[model samples]
Target chain A: MTSFNAALVRADTPQLTRVINGYPITYLDSGATSLPPRAVIEAMSRHYELHHANVHRSVFQTASEATEAYEGARLAIAKFINAPGGAEEIVFTKNCTESFNLLARSWGRVNLKQGDVVLLSEMEHHANIVPWFQLRDMLGFEVRFIPVTDDFRLDLSNIDELMKGVKLLSVTGMSNVLGTINPIKELSAIAHKHGALIAVDAAQSVAHSVTDVKDLDVDFMCFSAHKMLGPTGIGIFWTRKEILRDMPPFLGGGGMIADVSVDGYTPANGPTRFEAGTPPIAEAAGLGAAVTYLTGLGMANIAQHEHDLTGDALTRLELEFSGRIRVIGPRDMTNRGGVISIDVDGVHPHDVAQMLDQFGVCVRPGHHCAKPLMKRFGLNATARISYGPYSLVRDTDMLLEALHSAIGMFG
Target chain B: MAGLEDLYKEIIMDHYRSPRNRGELPTPPAVCTEGFNPLCGDQITVYIDVTDGVLKDIKITGQGCSISQSSSSLMSAAVKGKSLEQVQETIGTFKQLMTGHETALEDGGEPEKVDIRALGELAALQGVVKFPVRIKCAVLAWNTLSQALSELPS
Candidate 1:
């Protein structure tokens, strides 16, 4: 047995914790939005304190510095995700949802015609599915979904058949509810072979694992900063430079246009074309700092730690609860991330979550924005406990104890 | 263990184990409306048979958490055989009670105290207010019933 120690476990430090949650709060909702680390918090604070000026207009020192910092953040993000080109290919948006929406509205509007097919996975979060639905309603395109197997893994065996006649294939890199890490590299390759471009919702995977746009060979990928221990209200969209240059701008405003007139207007060059308004300046800096921090700690280490935690939790839950607790998704940890969804017999997920809350143990309960997946699984909802770098064995113990307490209450 | 007593009172368990008005009423005259909490996949289909402004029969069928199921079970029992106005008033009073707002019915009135004994099982759900997220679960059935009544054509 591996003896766990609590002495070395401290998340976000004290100062950063104050600004975020106002106390030493145990935040297990990292999959929703992670608690920002001290470096990220300090970076944003420093930006406000020293260089608080708008970008791309004023010739003053502060304005130039602000522009440099903001553009520098773009460069950092591009590097972090291993984009082939420079920052020019990276577009900053409100969040992952907006990024996918941008692609659907702009790219889908231009490329897809009536009866054109856009394929998706059953495990997609609402963000990925809903945008396509809106596109289908507006543009009269067909949206098809790749079926998930009985074990909840994407059924890649039928990819060849599904990819046929597909204009674009959009899928999630990792399922928020199932914790299934999709084989994006293989999926993208198959989509390409079938003459289709692929867009990946990396909102869950990018933060927890090493992700490279070049390595995956995906046409487009989007993820949020907040999920990766960065500030909220900022996200990244990494696309091929040539594709971005060809696609129409999502939002047309002062920043996105090179020349505007009553009759016609031309869009600005590079990623700035997609950024319509004044961006979230401080938030971008915080994201850049977050990427820097993650780089220092090494994402591989974080992924390994999360994997260990998930594996241990899965083993213990199965052992302790026996037949009473039914874990959703793949039993093996190889193709999974750190998320664990479990249904306790005779106990509702809300009751389980509430009981866990009383013990100061946090876990997410519900469909987790994956209603179709829940329907596919024939379950209303399941309680999900997702792990981060700060999660320890004791935290899992607290969850087990609270779960037992909740079950005993129903008994 | 916090024990079953704290969260699920005996009354609630009783209602859940043996729910009242748990099936469907007759059609045409019965107004059926569905309530869904997309966040947790809690769904309820309320069937109310209103005749001449009086709720002659009421039945509910759906799947949800215990709080939702039991609340629907109790609500069907409480409002059956009452006039439309009385049903409306009871629903309004219950909404106010659940939200912790002051309700005139709590004091003396024509409808009286609503004889909350049928709501016996539902009282355990009062603790749901403390767990604010589950408050929706507790109120889902009543909300659906309210919709069914509002949709009635005078």
Candidate 2:
């Protein structure tokens, strides 16, 4: 507990010191986008200041340095997730959304055809659902969902029937709205038993836990850098090198083509086949720095600190608010991450969020881009308070204080 | 408490807790349209029975924050007994207050304050205009009303 110093992490983040609404900034919206640490900021800035050039094709010195930095980031990310294929398997895209698009447009479009089923959990983010549906629209494949239980956990009772004819089992590792962490290895095992390739939407889980792709035995994994204390405009898509090598290129452009002629063009091999244009070089540097920063703090510590905080907050909120506000996510800390979604009786999420904002406690209020899950819960929206590695118990105290004020004002 | 009171004026809360004119009007002849804010999932359905050029009856129903629900309640109260033209005028004044315009002015130029007195308790929502985020909440019902009126037999 002493080793997990949120104060030190807070010090590394420059945004934590600022004042908002005459109150110290209590950021509880990390589920949307995490605040950047000085390490990430400086790495990106340093890249622009010193090493700035196009990647892959450049032969010059700065170009080679940039290429190395970019490749080094791939290595770092691959290692971070403990990917078996290492750097060769990691493909950088615009964000997690683009990564899913690549998987659906390239792999799903090529491998899946009519009657092929794609199994998705009901609680998946739109990033995991929409791309497959977009492909399903044209391909005529059946998209089935594993319904969520009333207690906010995935229902697997009918999973065997649901996985029939399923070509791909694409699901979120952790729900962005519910914070329920799915058992990835077990799900992968089930998907494999059903002869379906599994893809993990690691957008929420990758930042919160130890993500070992090899251990989980997942075929494909995608996550956004911004959610993991890195820069935006960069995301990671990981798969085994052999599978990625054979898949047709998603976007055909300069960097993605090995040979181009007036009559025809040949797409490059490996992950580069997917990366279309000049990659996010500076962002790669920021991601690399973020990797180093997280590595230094140790992901296990970050996970533990946030878990304790979440357990504490849930206890306090339930005890204090009691009948006023009900938690939408798992009440137990086990199998759940740091996301806390709550429904205030007789109050809208927008009102709750606005009242919280008056006290400089930022929390996201909406469907959280999971409309199906919202409809599943019969909820329009819920006020979500998410924690980052830098978040502390004090943030939770301020959130509760704001909650009391908001409830009192309405009463 | 100080900051919150400005936003959730007592009158606003009263109207929110018990919104007036909330329900589906009988059947046809009464035009109804729904306004939805996709960002926060706030939705409002405005139902109006316009006989000839006058609003014989109007109802505002939806689910959302206090500002939107209360604004809908007050809006239904204000426009229920007014002619079509008068309802349009009230809509313009509410929009001006929310967007900070000159619908408050009488004839000559006075202060830039909103015409809260004319709008009645509806003017209590003027505090929302300061919060750029909540501006849409205050005007969602009014927008739905306009949409509903647009479809009214002309």
Candidate 3:
């Protein structure tokens, strides 16, 4: 048994109370998004009830309060990720997809040219892959993929050769489908050795592990609030202050500009240069509370908690299902998270997900926005069950119960 | 609150388990068109061999859930021996059945009830509308079939 009491954490999540289809909701889709705790909801509601106003502009008291709430969230997020450049390095976007788009459009266009190469992995979600491909089409830069090994690890054996002519190495810190925890610290060193900048998509790993940007030494990192017990509509794009200062602003609008006229305008300094229009102020308040909640839980404890759950679940799944089920990710617990994608013999993933839904067990069934990886494995889709800090062993027990029924039904 | 039985009717499951006309035909003689539900990565390739305005043969080759695969099987069985005009009528009625109330609402009138009797065995898939997300899975092969018919050498 793990030291961390996930049932206690689950009690604070209001969504856990709901009963679906005559059964309690067994939410196992945290890889897609996490459920916000009561603290996050209350903080958001409090912002709307007491201090609701537009941020950064008005001289009035409420506006300042709103600005403080918004900026305070940035500070909390910066501290959460241990960003060396502090809040100045954090640029808010719509979500992790927008963050990657900002990185590709702003930094990519300026730095990369015809002969340059961008190295991405086959395991990357479409969010990380599509933006660079979109940029590569316009910039005429070559894009290469680091192949995935048969055992579901990044084939870094040819890393040195693949890194040649690669100006940027972009990869996910943890695969949403496979739950493979990448070696970001080592990859960062390899990228630097090849004179290429590295970007880590921490969208999946941010909530499950401790992400210190300083220790990783990654040039860029991106994550979303919704996947980390926070509200939707807000995400973070973090880079060093030096790189952020040099890169041009992505979206052109009122808040992003330093000075404007009929002629071309100069962009503002710091993170605000990229944040145009009204930002997600209410969402930011929720995110701030979420950060505080996660900090209180202690990230190390959450990591260990998930690690224990994953090990137990993997062992049970193999023992119970045997030949009927095949895990699509690494069997070993080392460098793995709580994501478990499985392919049931003779049953489609969608069908499995549909049956699980009958038991009120929420699991995602699809390619998981990682079609390249799916193609690599010769699979159309997989039924993926992921975990959050609130997830418990009983959840996996319910999952096993549901899977037994699903397979029996299909049979 | 429709149960799993409603979505996966006995006849539908039978068709899914042992799909009819499950392989592909030669491309030169049989025109092939593909449809994809990108959301779930469900793909279908529809091949049809039409002669003298009659669909002599219809085959389905794809990978998807029961809803999609079974719907294709049902569709192939229904249209394989029909004239082009009859096949077009069946397609119209099936699409109407799938659309349910949306078509009637668009015309600003009473909810035009789908006549299930007219749909024959295809009516077994009517429960798919209760779950909106699965509707795409049911219609993917039909869309590809329609595309193939439209592109037929006229």
Best by TM-score: 3
**After superposition, which runs of candidate 3 have C-alpha atoms over 4 Å from their true positions?**
A1-4, B102-113
What's model 1's lDDT at B127?
51
Model 2 chain A lDDT-worst window of ten: A1-10
Off by over 4 Å in 2: A1-3, B100-112
Per-model DockQ? 0.40, 0.56, 0.87
How much RMSD separates candidate 1 from the native structure? 4.6
Arranged by lDDT with the best first, the candidates are: 3, 2, 1
lDDT of 2 by residue, A1-411 (tens): 125589999999999999988999999999999998999999998899989988877699999989999999999999999989889899999999999999999999999999899999999999999998899999999999999999899999988989999999999999999989999899999999999999999999888888899999999999999999999999999998888987898988878888999999999877788888888999999999998888888888888888999999999998999999999989977889999999999889999998888889999999999989999988889999999999999999999999998888777
Cα lDDT for residue A375, candidate 2: 92
Please, what are the lDDT tens digits per residue for candidate 3 over residues A104-124?
Answer: 999999999999999999999
DockQ for candidate 2, please give it.
Answer: 0.56
Name the docking class for model 1. Answer: acceptable
User: Model 1, A128-151: lDDT tens per residue?
Assistant: 999989989988979999999999
Worst 10 residues of 3 chain A by lDDT: A1-10
lDDT of candidates 1 onward, in order: 0.82, 0.90, 0.94
Q: Per-prediction TM-score, please?
A: 0.91, 0.95, 0.97
Instruction: Give residue A254's error in model 1 in angstroms.
Output: 1.9
Give candidate 3's whole-model lDDT: 0.94
lDDT of 2: 0.90
